[model samples]
Target: MTSLNLLLWIVLGIALQVGLFLGISFWQHWQSYSRLRQGLPEAAEALPAVDVPQKEAAGWSGFRRLKVARRVVEDSSGHICSFYLEAEDRQPLPSFKPGQFLTFRFDAPKADGSGSEQITRCYSLSDAPTPEHYRISIKRVPPAPGGIHPPGRSSNFFHDHIEVGTTLQVRAPSGHFYLEPGSSPIVLIAGGIGITPMLSMLNWCQAHQPGREVWFYYGVRNSRETAFAAHLGAIAAAHPNVHLRLCFSDPLAEDQAGKDFHHHGRVDVNLFRIELPLKPFHYYICGPTPMMETLVTALEDWGVPDSHIHFEAFGPASIKRRNAGAAIAGDAVAAPAGDITVTFAKSGKAAQWSPQSGSLLEFAESQGIAIDSGCRAGGCGTCQTTIRSGEVSYLQSPDCDPEPGSCLMCVCTPRTAVTLEA
Candidate 1:
């Protein structure tokens, strides 16, 4: 093989692969159109779309010891991995809403190496519910570019230490961001690690609501960063009603235009506008704060109603609704002229709070008071603290259902002079 011949062979191989992919895509699309022209089979009863109530999450209640039965690498970039967990006791598992998350309690080692600190974290279930196992996909949050901040502790532990047979304490799956049980059309938008829950929803739709139309848009940097590439493509090809678009913001040289990804830019409403025919679509979006805020705002600007615009935001939400119903649901905090006092009863600490000061947790941290917290977005109840008195208002709507007598310190601010059993 001469140098020129070798180059020709490589080019020919790539061309063949691209041709095969395009052929498959076109065939699947034709099959879908044929099915539509013929008409789909009637759907069965609709499942409930409501969020899982706390008490109803699992009749067993509390955390259960589950062991990792399998671990699979999801992406070529070595960033995303999935773990399949089975109850150690071999008992039956509770069913969850398609987009719910499972909470994990970790005894992470302290920085001083003196002892372990109890840390809580939440990861969304990444597959449809099964009788034997539950799966979760997680991406390792790499260290900051300049090392300004340390890498995520829980994610690192899962990647480095956790393996098949590792036992873990996991809570029942729960979250407000889930696919409602309905036959209506829906739009699923996911970015980076945010694709975890969307996977669950997509899988469930395929398994149960096979006739329903689903527009799934997943955004990644490139092919290497993409998870379940062939799997998603296969799903889309299998179901004509399920439309999948892989959007790569920065595609690699090896990535082909039609096979590797469908779009060259980020996943936004513009793509939706360009691709989808005008119709009412309930949106479920999950991604980074900037992407979430920008996409949600754009959708709203496009006349999508607040109720139709459902998004999953972990950590304190940075997005705010432009609609008049923007205020988070809760009793009005009676803050007298932006003047409020919050006291940590356990620590005998009191501090003044203002909108400029931030959330109760942040305000407390600034005042040198420490509170145990996880997810910081109110998805995990680690920051739930007993409110001895006074009212608190959530700066953003929480995905976790609020407690009757407590507040998630990470998301809420004191409305008046409040004391908490932190």
Candidate 2:
């Protein structure tokens, strides 16, 4: 055949193949649709729309808040707010080993039909376990993209409108920042609102056993923004073993009453190395991103071993731990890699999940399941559930696991088809 005829035949052959594929696909789709229409009865009862009502979070309580009715403006710093909340669950609040944080739920405005509920965030519980309440000092973050705030939410709302008697839904406390109880001669480094968790350790020390030599290096903008100053000062005065050092990035008027409370500039590696006691001690450090980076690097440069250093990032561990490895949560369970279904036993609801969803906790929350949780970072173990039938890829060890049979659904992304008893 001529070249033109061969080209024509080839073109026709390609067209025919494409037409055959399209016809088969269309027929298959029509058959499937017909079967679905016949097998599924006409919508006799419409599905009840998910009703996620808008909720208002009340002020904090438990060891979280002191008995005194102190409003946000009541404290000397004006940044500190104290208030009470009616117990919601009546289940005794979970105890912590000082240095853990409480995750609180806050609803945000969403234009989509999702009813404006947003992610839950955790803040360090600043009070001792005994006070029977959780206390957290928030610095009021601005709206940042890809963070808890797409617009004003959580901390911003807490600072702006949260008032006394406004009950907040709090998760159980969890953290790794607690003192080992004579872990080493203690050295705490804090910047800005980072003082909350460290303060918990300090408070516990003051009441329980007062002899451990403790030193605090707190950095803040100025005296006006410093929180828990008087109370911390009292703890320092009452316990001679406790030494407090304050640094101010911006110190107002020299030789004044408040001037004594301030340090000239930022708290750098030089200052920390010089001010800290000569003896090696357990170091608990927290603060802004830059401060953490600088201090942690400084500690390493000063020959501090990883075993001796402990720190809590201000918010999520995402920012705080840059090179930290993923925390695994469960023992090895053999299962095929595939889609898994999560059944909320209480609500009679189930949601299919994949690794991309991050954790069962996130999936359930997205599905509007009210699983109590704190420190979604896997430290607190509040959003834990039993492995009913299938298995999960728990990123954290089972020992620190919340419940023995259960897994912390936060860091646990499914590696196989799994069903959790929610």
Q: Give me the candidate number with maximum TM-score.
A: 1
What are the per-residue Cα lDDT tens digits for candidate 1 across 337-367? 5768888999998887888887888888998
* Candidate No. with top lDDT: 1
Q: For model 2, how many clashes?
A: 21
Kindly list the per-residue Cα lDDT of model 2 for residues 153-219, writing each as its tens digit.
5666677667665666555555445666443467888888788888888877665656667888888
| Cα lDDT for residue 302, candidate 1 | 78
Compared with the true structure, all predictions reach lDDT values of 0.81, 0.62
Please give the lDDT score for candidate 2.
0.62
